[model samples]
Target: MMIDLSRDINLLTKFSIFSKFPLDHLEHLLNCCGAYYKSYEKNEIIYFQGDDINFLCIIISGSISIEKIDIFGNNTYMLDFYSGNFFGEQMILDTPSISPYTYKCSTKCKILCLPFHKKYSTNNCKNTCDCRLLFRENLLNQIAENNLLFINKLEVLSKKNIREKIMTFLINESEKCNSNKVQIPFSKSKFADYLGVNRSALMRVLSNMKNDGLIELNNKTFTILK
Candidate 1:
């Protein structure tokens, strides 16, 4: 699975983390790495809970669900990743016995897998080279973002009931859309998963919101009334 390094480097440069790295460094990494392109059908498992981690996966297109499964086989979702996001970095630092989670394609996905040599030992810490610094900065940014998201979810969940959570999510989404009319980018099931609620609860909340005259919903389209 050979790739044109120049082309891929150019595409990667548009990503926030990789953008900070000089193109030369990315090109160098590309040269040192072997890449493969693969696609997965919707809901397909890209890697299992304890699969051998041999490569880092970068999303080229589409989305993936990162999930963790306990020994009892109960699953909890971690996140949904879109294009330009990388996964499996934890594997780079952990032993084979300490597998963290599984990565599954929520939708059809295209990914670039960069296989690393068993003994590759270049630390991409912030204080190192520009490329390494970029990597560290990006990682820190993701951590901060995730922390904020966690806090927001907690706050929402602490509300009196599901109605409040639904209203809050709608208000936030409306603001993000820059208009009262907003179309949810994901399905109700995905929204339920994100809010840590059941689909029936979400539907009930939406119905309650509509009855309260706070919003109007037509299929996936929602209009928040001021």
Candidate 2:
């Protein structure tokens, strides 16, 4: 659906990157960027691996997930892309690079795509030049953080045993929450998928851990006791 540009600008400004635009140039900036909204059903594939990516995509509502498939065709849950998070800045660069993961809408989704035009230069944006620079920095920061997270997950999953993997994963979750009591975000089955473990093995490990008093588990809620 075509939304009023002003209203759409208002929604965009809520994000940190868009908020960098000067108040006076914000509307003009949006006009120059060129954007449109797209809706999708739950479980619908948004982008298949190796597809050409060219535009910035922001989830206006609902959720998306990036699933990575290995050479053996084993699928691993990578990350969830939620509302307010933006991606695909790398696609804007002149160099060629393709998407490595399959993207699918985890729920009914509304996505906003902004064209990354090569013609648009900051030389023309003299008044909002600083804002544009800051916007670039924000994009780089996001990309760096995302890469770091994947590296961290690789470290977590490289553990040799299920108990080691589960405990490492929980400890990382604890760091995010800033507390020992951490809530698992996914249901048991999905949680197993995210952790790259067998569901039944995960259940048995949790039971053993609780019995050993290494941790306490109540459904999805876990408390790191010892």
Candidate 3:
């Protein structure tokens, strides 16, 4: 679909990778990367596990989920990416790479797709272009940030019980948001998926936690009372 490039570019500039780029250079880089935008409706699958992955994607609006579906068709939520966040980096560099998880839109959204090994990026690695160099550094930073988030999820999963898991996850969220009261991107069911727990059990634990005075819950926002 057609988009207003100026408006779209402005939106992208909010991210550090593109923030320092001059308008002209950014446009050139987009052209060199063969960047394009696509729209998805809520719950639409953007990519499935094992699907060929040829591009990196950034969310322009709305949210996306990285998920794993088991043989029995049960899905586990792995991560959420919101506006200005990107994914598909892990497989983007390999020849004939395949997706490791399913990517689904959590809301009606727009995504920017760019080939991993594009002209601008490739040339920048070999030569000196201030804009491209800055972009590379920012891209690497983004990948590292994703890795840290994965580590945090792993920490949450390491807890043995549902209560411990919930506490760990919420504590991590509190730290990330720098507030005791934190907002979760997922609904109860989706949060259960992320925790790899049954929804009914998750709800029960949350109720118990609330009663124990350990946390105060109001819909998606949880305030750690401890």
* Candidate number with greatest TM-score: 3
- Which lDDT tens digits does candidate 3 get at residues 122-144? 65344256555666778888888
Write the residue-wise lDDT of candidate 2 on 1-226 in tens digits.
Answer: 5547656777777876565666556566555566678899999987778787766777899888889888999877986777877666656544464777888988999988766465335334543465556666666776776787677678778999989988898888898889999987668887787678899999999999999999988888999998
**Clashing pairs in model 1?**
none
Q: Which pairs of residues have clashing backbones in candidate 3?
A: none
True lDDT of residue 7, candidate 2: 60
TM-score of each predicted structure versus truth? 0.77, 0.85, 0.88
lDDT of residue 110 for candidate 1 = 87
Alpha carbon RMSD to native, model 3: 2.7
RMSD of each: 3.7, 2.9, 2.7
Model 3 regions more than 4 Å off: 69-74, 90-96, 116-128
Residue 42's C-alpha lDDT in candidate 1?
93
Q: Candidate 1: which stretches are off by over 4 Å?
A: 70-72, 92-99, 118-129, 158-160, 171-182
Q: Candidate 1 at residue 177, lDDT?
A: 61
User: lDDT per residue, candidate 1, 1-226, as tens digits?
Assistant: 5667756777877876566667787766555554577888999987888887777778888998878787898887755778877776654444453336788898899888866554234343223455545555675676565466556656766777777777777776676668888886578897887677899988988888899888898988998874
lDDT of each: 0.71, 0.76, 0.82
Best by lDDT: 3
Give me the overall lDDT of model 3: 0.82
Superior candidate under TM-score, 1 versus 2: 2
Off by over 4 Å in 2: 3-11, 19-26, 119-128
